[model samples]
Target: MNCYQKEDLIKMVEDAKQLTQKGKVADYIPALGEADPSTLAVAIYSGERECIYAGNIDEVFTLQSISKVLTLALALMDRGADYVFQRVGMEPTGDPFNSISKLESSVPSKPLNPMINAGALAVTDMLVGNTIEDKLERLLNFIRQLTGNDRITYNPVVAQSEFETADLNRSLCYFMRQHGIVESNVEQLINLYTKHCAIEMNCNDLAKLGFVIGNEGRDPNSDQNIIPLEIARIVKTFMVTCGMYNASGEFAIKVGIPAKSGVSGGILGSVPHGVGIGIYGPALDDKGNSIGGLRLLELIAKQSNLSIF
Candidate 1:
């Protein structure tokens, strides 16, 4: 099967919009709650010059959990896998992303994986910096390099909203502290996590980032290696197994590619040696995946035989 043509991809985008009603916008954060539920968009990149877009492709949204993938890669690069893995396990939790129960039940209390809230918080703590500002700048710069866009930035309003409503996350952080899993200042770590989650980008930016990962950590445009090949392989493995939160198993069985979803209704997908896909739809299913976005990916994967399985 061939890569999807621009016209056919646009049609797929249009057809997937009907699924918007099947999910609801993520409103618990208040900032994410403001997204227009009817909006849907997609962008695909195979090379620097080969790009396809459809729907509200220009609309900017927060990275949310999708940022975790980048942070995990950075942590792996900054600190080797052994050090990072010591604080966080590699297995999926089979629980909700924000579940506190898993933290309580685990014997040693290490976060199950870097994709969950607990694990991401611990990974965020590993980002070497003297202050939260320094750490955030490092993260944003890394993302800018990945997408080849220097203009990427954080959404302060969204960050503030999450901070104000972060009682549960605070609890998780303190729980980690209690168990010796995280030793950083709780407020500072939460602030950094929330701020990174608030980083804003459009489908095109995400597709470009995915493009680099799809090609095994090399920038397709500059032909430069961004992330080490080994690190990229580890990150992609985690994305395939744990990226979609508790719904990861179902998504793997259906989509059969490495992908990550955010509550902001964005999904980042990479088809090894094939293409990178970015999708945005603010309506979230019960499992916190973008309803329309997942539908679009299923259609594309099925039609193009994009599934790795």
Candidate 2:
């Protein structure tokens, strides 16, 4: 496939940014509620070359649900998939990220994999450490290593907002505890989970970090095995199956790439041997994915034949 010229890519991004007007920034978090509705950017990292972007590429944004995929990989690296799966199932729920219906049901509702809020919360609870500080240190280290950025930090405003409005997540944690799925204190787990969801990253860092997955858990630049190949495979599978909240299936059909989206208006996509792409446009669809980001990804993947299937 021919590589797209830098100018062409820029134009595509400009065209894609127009999508932001049709969607709304996530208002659940007052911090995210203030993002420039028209802000849009795209970054593609391949081997040693970086596209380093357009529009709002430099704007710092929280990881939101995208942090789930990273934490899930860390948990798998620490506990292996078998143990992790026991705590969370591997299926898509066709439901909102914060939905409480499944938790309230009598049916044995294991989390449908570690990409959704429930599963990610469960996975975050499993990160091995005696204290929340240690866990946060370790998680931050993992994220920093993947993104190749040592300065990354969590956004306090976003974390505080999520903590304040996280009733559904708290309920989910409580439900996990009742089901014996959560091994840690419910409140503590929610605290760690919210902080993780609040970790801040821009498009360049997000794309490079996601490139680790496309590179099969190995950091292309560092040549370090950040995660076992098996663990990476499981994470990618979950990304494809349930990464975009309830719209994962439709995204897979249209974009045909393994990706994860966060309520912070970011999408992280991986195409084997092609690219690791990141897009940011805080306006969200009902499922919480950035509508413009999703559209750009679909166009790029369709044109580039990047689908894993």
Best by lDDT: 1
TM-score for all models, in order of appearance: 0.98, 0.95
Cα deviation of 276 in candidate 2 (Å)?
0.7
Segments in model 2 whose C-alpha atoms lie over 4 Å from true places: 1-4
**What's the count of clashing pairs in each model shown?**
0, 0
Give the clash total for candidate 2.
Answer: 0
What would the per-residue lDDT of candidate 1 be over residues 150-260, giving only the tens digit for each residue?
Answer: 999999999999999999999999999999888899998999999999999999999989988878999987889899999999999999999999999999999899999
Candidate 2 on 1-309: residue-level lDDT in tens? 234466666777788878888899988788789988788888888757565465668888898989899898888888887898887888788888887676566257677667767778888988989898899989999999888899998987788888888888888888888888887887788888889889998899988877888888888877998878888787788888998889989988888888999988989987766678888888887678898888888777776678888
Error of 2 at 219 (Å): 1.4
Model 2 worst lDDT window (10 residues): 1-10
Model 1, position 105, has a per-residue lDDT of 89
Worst 10 residues of 1 by lDDT: 1-10
lDDT of 1 at 262: 97
Q: What is the Cα-based TM-score of model 1?
A: 0.98
Q: Give the TM-score of candidate 2.
A: 0.95
